[model samples]
Target chain A: MIAAGLDPIAQFELHKIQELKLGPIDISFTNSSLMMVFTVALIGLWLLLSTRKAALVPGRAQSIAEMSYEFIADMIRSTAGKDGLRFFPFVFSLFIFILFANLLGMIPFFFTTTSHIIVTFTFAMMVIGLVVVYGVWKNGFGFLKLFWPAGVPAVLKILLVTPLEIISFLSRPISLSVRLWANMFAGHILLKLFAGFMIMMVSAFGVFKGGLAALIPFSLTLALTPLEFLVAFVQAYVFALLTCVYLSDALHPGHH
Target chain B: MTYLFDMFGYGFAAAASAAETVADYKGDQDGGAAFPPFDPTYFPSQIFWLLVTFFVLYFMLSRIFLPRIGSMIEERSNRIADDLDMASRLQLQAEQAQSSYEQELADARAKAHNIGATTRASVEAEIAKDVEAADVEADRQQAGADARIATIRNQALKNIDKVAADVAAEIVEKIGGFTPNTATVKTAVG
Candidate 1:
């Protein structure tokens, strides 16, 4: 059995694959691949179950489904406009998948797929790729004009403006990936660390003194559990929100 | 990097034994590593769902749902406006009718007042004429009554004087012892 207080970084490293091999280019499932499949199945089953009988007077499950639907729908509409209505399904799906994955990690002995940088970076790249493609599709070559604002002094544009735009553009994937991975990574580590503290105190002090010392960390862990849950939800929201903002830039390329 | 090597030591050991056990699982044998290397290339689950969800929502809203809702709202707004206009016209008509009725009432009241004043003046004039006629009739009747009473008193006094004269004649005859000569004549004349 894996010991408690094992290094958090070591846990991550254990999961990481150091090399790749070519095989029957057809169908072999790895851990990450399995996780991807599970996420898809989860999303499909969730929607299918939730919307089976979409009651006008929503039942508890239906209410949750509708709230989720509206949450992401309004999010897209607000950030991306009525035109962004087209993007709602994609954004909403993303929100649900991430939300479920984050929530799933809260269960004991479950893998948090989003805790890895590779998984997060891949999602970030997909979103960024979509934005670029959609922007170009919607606005044509005029999409390049997004990097250049009108009415700028000619000299200053080369020195200051171009680099800033490029950096800002490149920063999207970095920010997106890091935001999700870091939050999940830190949160899980914190929970593990606190739990370790609680155990250590209770064992070291014995039933009377140890139990009393254990209570402090126990209570603290309890407090942080809900906070971690909140963080999970928040990270999901941030991911979706940034996606919408990126999509908006694509949809309306000329706007700053 | 060192940490990665340390962490994977156990997994590698486990994989090597598992490889010997199962020849069917043959892909990892070619690589020095017993297991597959971590490929960051896989697209996360979020991408697939995001695409699916966006398309479904887009189709549902743009094609089937929003248009119906928008039309309903527009219809309701129009209905409310029509109702308000109807109410306003009805109110205006009611006000006009009320004013007309009030005006008619005022006119009737003025006419009634005029008629009452004229009737009162006519009645006063008639009363004054009747009183004057009554006073004249009373004066005529009193004058006639006074005339008849004065004639009756004069006749009574004459009759009384004639009777006293006759009595005096009889007394004279008896005392002188001579027969008294009598004549048939009205006492009043005598």
Candidate 2:
């Protein structure tokens, strides 16, 4: 077995810092939990401090806060229309939380909460749950029309199209959750692997020859670091965008 | 070509070995060693903490942060609109003041022109009346002078007849010793 130090997968390990029990269940606080708390606190403090003055002409930090607000607002507006602004807080929270979590994970030795499937899955399930509940509550039986698209032959609709639509609808949360989790997971692993290769070369070939050989993986790691950063931000954006699109479906499921 | 093939073979070997490591790790996982992410043991705690943090964030954002930013934006827009309205209104007032000033200037120019024309007309009329009055007075003075001259000539004529008669009488006494009457002399001289 590779030592835990060089193991690419080892970074994802959860270490319980505090142990707690709720009857039969172990609900101890772990590194993942700590990172999550840090993410939340960071977001809270950044926003609070940035908006403390709330000047007419925004300063640098305020501009970032306002820009993020407008970015999500524009996303929702473009996808889900003006009415979808009601879900602004929900969408904003999801976007910023994921964004901070992903970015914080990019730091050395930080646990990435979002790299876990369960975490992403939980958020995805919440989004889908909201969609279904809102769609049904607002449209009643008409929400099912999302499955029955317009303009198809009724025969094809019942046999093929409807079932496909239903399956697609059911798969939204899985696709959304898996997309984010897999991106973060794979990117982190790749980074670790390249870094491990650099170290491995140095150890295997001795300092002089190995260090020269390590430059190859080291350069790759350097290149991938920026790409991973891009992936982090893009994944967050895609998650929020998909949420808006799905919510738009809930808002006006009558449209194809 | 051989060197390239060797490099490719090395890459494949490395990848294959990495795969083996991953497979072994998976086998270990199956043997009750949990992979951190896929481990079911950590699910409950992560979910619980996630729920706690996410809701807290949602509450803070919805209740506090979002409204403050939204209101600031709304207030700025409103202030801008009000400022624009005030600026336009002030501009309108300025334009009105300029127009009224121009109007008053035009009215003042007309009044000044009227005063100048009336003064010129009245001065010219007074000058014409003074000239007419001076002409009439000069005419009357000339007629009076003519009448006085005629009377003085008539008196002189009468005096000359008497004097001539007296001279003739003297001459006749000195020569023929005869003198005509004064009345006859006066008729002859007239």
Please give, for residues A28-120, the per-residue lDDT of candidate 1 as tens digits.
243444454566566556655655664444577656666666687788888888898777766765676678778887876666777766667
In candidate 1, what are the lDDT values of residues B1-190, reduced to their tens digit? 3533332343345334433423422332343332211323333323343344445544544454334333443555677889899999999999999999999999999999999999999999999989989989888998898888888888888777677667655665678665455453233226
Question: Where does candidate 2 chain A have its weakest 10-residue lDDT segment?
Answer: A1-10
lDDT over C-alpha atoms for residue A178 of model 1: 71
Q: Which residue runs does candidate 1 get wrong by more than 4 Å?
A: A1-35, B1-190
Chain A TM-score compared with the true chain A, each model in order: 0.87, 0.98
Going through the candidates in order, the fraction of native interface contacts each one reproduces equals 0.02, 0.60
lDDT of 2 by residue, B40-147 (tens): 999999899999999999999999999988887778889999999999999999999999999999999999999999999999999999998999998999999999
DockQ of 1: 0.03
Worst 10 residues of 1 chain B by lDDT: B31-40
